[model samples]
Target: MENLFSHPESEPEPSQQDDDALEPFIITVVVPTNVSHAFQGFTDHPHLWWPLDQESVFGEGSHVEFEENLILETAEDGRTSVWGTIDDWQPPLSFHASWYPASTPLWSTEIRVSFRAVEEGTEVRLVHDGWEGAEDPAASRASYAEGWPRVLERYVRFMGGAVA
Candidate 1:
């Protein structure tokens, strides 16, 4: 089967901060479905599979929001973005956004998630890069590395139930 998580030849390499600074962290987890099932549907159902520890800002008529006050707005064309109050929303098959912590120097970073179909399953690749402002890049990378697995596991389980 083809490697669904492979980056495009034109894609730029992740920025490197410093030798001691933590390198860009990328994690890919293959789900047993297509991109439509893996991203749009799975992500839209925040209530069923969102991280319990994180605060969600979703309601009957509001966009899905996160604890860091990031608002996830979906366009009519099926594009999604995590936007700040001032920034414009832009969408792509895979894109980047800022991950700002509440009390920090607004640590800027980008998270790119892509989905591709493969024979065995759908490859959900999550690449979080641009950790330039983090106090400890290594620690930051370790935390996200651990967190994505748990999040993806929950998503996979949830999707499995829907399929069954």
Candidate 2:
């Protein structure tokens, strides 16, 4: 899965890779922490950092676990729902996942996040691609472009990292 998202890898930062009708939305942020810590903020501490107001498969107060191999949510009653599959699970470096949220569960999109240690701290780059799966790719991309920044802002706050 990493191989699938490693294209245009020469760019240290975010690089756009246009493929057919889909264009990847790249969001890069600098966190004031080590690579390992930043990675943990995204994976291990998702419940603490991820914005919960958005559309979710398990709804609020659900026990959500975004693991290396799978993303799942469990209700209080023990009902479980799977949202995505983590294909590449490299720690402190990168990971790739196929995301299928509740709103549009019929299809999936590719999400890749890379963590790199920098002089200031860590660089977390997120790429959300595969918009072709959406019913309205352009609209969905537009919504995410506005939403991801806010979500990352919350993550930076939770990690005590500054977005540079």
lDDT of each: 0.56, 0.79
By TM-score, the best candidate is: 2
Error of 1 at 57 (Å): 11
| Candidate number with greatest lDDT | 2
Error of 2 at 20 (Å): 11
Tell me the TM-score of each prediction against the true structure.
0.59, 0.77
Q: What is the C-alpha RMSD of each candidate to the true structure, in Å?
A: 13.9, 10.7
Over 4 Å off, model 1: 1-21, 54-92, 101-105, 161-164
Q: How many residue pairs clash per model?
A: 0, 0
- Candidate 2: count the clashes: 0
lDDT (Cα) of model 1: 0.56
